[model samples]
Target: MAMSSTCAQLCLRCRGFLGSKTSTRLHYIQSHHWRIWTANSKSLSNGLFTNGSFTSTQTRQRLKQHMCYYNNLTVKYLTTEAKENKNADDTVRSTDGANLPQMPNTTALSIPENMNSLDLDAFNEPSALEEISDEEAVTIPFPTIPPSSTSLRDYVGKSETLTNLVQLGVDLWKLEQRPNVGSMLLRLDFSTDVAPRLLFLKNIGVEDSRLGYIISHNPFILTEELENLQTRVNYLVSKKFSTETVASMVSKAPYLLNFDVKRLDNRLGFYQHQLKLSASNTRNIIARLPRLLCGSLEPVKENLKVYEIELGFKLNEIQHMVIAVPKMLTAKKQKLTRIFDFLHNTMKVPHHLITKFPQVFNTNLLRLKERHLFLEYLGKAQYDPTLPNFISLDRLVSLPDETFCTEMALATLEDLYLFQKTL
Candidate 1:
């Protein structure tokens, strides 16, 4: 009897309920004085049901809803496909895969199987797609092609492409009103705002004799071609900068290029641009040099005085050569004679005599100045962080007289400013 009751309890626990069967079992026990209830028993057994049977009924109802949903979905898909097929047949369109549009045959591109979504023919002629107004096109963002495997050059050549190539060759090789290089530069400048990729090609590799060579060799030119012009120019300009002391003066500075004297020589690393100078510019430079000092045609004592002041702390071999200008400037203008006398006279002056007294005649004063000046000017010393620390010797030599003077003044100002910065 206890065993039967235990079985009934187990069944009720498994079913997650004890309401009806449990109550019947309790009534049978209280009124009829029976503790156990068998499954086959007449009274309480009829009210009981198994948990598994109830679970199966719930599962069947959920399955019915799912089946109904699947049928609806299948019917809808079939209806859409049938309508599309009917419309296609009415138009008499060929359903063969070969009839579908193909990707433009870019020279040689091996597309991967995973990129099946990409329409190769669409990339075949970029210009055709470009002609479609932006409003008509649907732009979908796609993943970038890996640099190692993808080649964009295949897509670039077209009928008009040859015309552009010929024009570029002519621009580089043929002469213009100014000169071939000048014409190329001017033509490139005009297209600067409209087509910057072309400008970047011209700007860099200025030293390369042929445009075609430059285009093929420079990775930057390739990248710039893919991007817009403004972005290309900004990047190219930044790349052209140098590590020298005068780097800042020439980089991103206004009117600075105009001041460069070596603009025409194309020798110094800096002389790619033309320094436009007038005849008047030449005259101004000759006038600015301290005139042949005195009636004797030699640099006067006054000229030496100014040299002493210019040297600031001390004089070196160059500065001492400058000091002997008086004796070197004799009546004749032979280059060797002038250089010789200048060196000879300064070496004759004794160092001890110059330092004993603060006066210019003190021989040691001049020699001591030479020693100090050599160390100070050995490298173009930077005085300010904002300006160039060094001036270019080659550039200074090539510059027109007036421009050279301007450069000197600028250098002097830079040196003074840097000195002040330290304080």
Candidate 2:
């Protein structure tokens, strides 16, 4: 190989790594190749002598009296060719290291004195991927996300049964109602407990993508008996709900199938007879709000009573309110009562107007109160849209807070905030 002139110089700098630059050089004498240096300072003179390139006569005299320290302290090396000219007594080689000619533009490296010869040669790490094993990618143990990311993911790494479910995209966060589902999942056999339900749902026309979210939202659907689930579907069909409507209802509220067949029959009967909802209207309401059947029938009955007896709404107005917002049928009786009392006595909103725009039930009572009070504060509390300075009830709650403050309230958000704080 050829040699480069800029070699073996940088190792002499011996500063930090930043101060060091990459260099191509290697230098070695026969035996001093990896030798350690020691001082021969058994005897010492009283003082040390120095000079500034010996420009003055005193510097030359002092240099002449003492040793040539600069030349003595500097290391001197013989090149490969020069070693042949040197006496054999000055050159030596150890049998342990390989004998190689001193080459230029190469780095000199030696194993440390304490390191074993085979240790350096044998230290190799396996090159396999650490995040996931190939076998896990294919089978009942998928790579898991952190527990903090979603509730059941941590269990996936440890529970073989859960790994496949997570792989299928079941979002465990929606299972907030089942706090111990992670441990409970370990006991279920996915092939028997879950796979049949998945097939049944798909056969019933539930979309494939919604399977995971529906199962997570209502975990009981998976554990529910296949026979029972099919019976509920059949009952809906018996009631003239289409196959598409049944599947749509399941997707919207998975717990709809979890209800007992008799209880479901009673719910369907209540809508038909007691509430006097027409067959088409009942179907429309169920198709829109499927979870209306999830809870017991008592709350629905009580809210209907509150709308009629407690709030003094007529039969047609109640039916119109139900048709306008199906959710009001299942809303808490107390909440319905509070909204009615405030709108009736305080805001003086007419009962028929409340029935026509029953979506006002969706707004928070506190917000309704604050807006009404703020409008009164500004002396613009007129609600009847035909009257002067009328504010639309729809815009009051439907508009965003900032938009409502600017357009309807005619006040800044700061004023509303201060007014709410006082309330």
Q: Write the per-residue lDDT of candidate 1 for residues 1-423, one digit (tens) a residue.
A: 333454355445423432453344333433232222222233322233243343545644643543343334323323433455455654554554344333222223332333213222332354643566576556745444222212222222322332354445433232222223322232332234224545443453333235544433221232333344334334324434322312222222212222223331221221111112233332222122212211232333333333345322244432333233223222233333332233234333233322222222212233333322332454432222246653332232244434533554343444533544543
TM-scores for the candidates: 0.20, 0.58
The sequence of per-residue lDDT tens digits that candidate 2 reaches over residues 342-393 is: 9889999998778768889988998888888988988888888678888878
Count of backbone clashes, every candidate in sequence = 19, 2
Best by TM-score: 2
Which numbered prediction scores highest in lDDT against the true structure? 2
Q: Which whole-number lDDT from 0 to 100 does residue 385 have in model 1?
A: 29
- Taking all chains together, the TM-score of candidate 1 against the true structure is 0.20
CA lDDT, candidate 2, residue 25: 19
What TM-score, to 2 decimals, does candidate 2 have? 0.58
RMSD of each: 25.5, 15.0
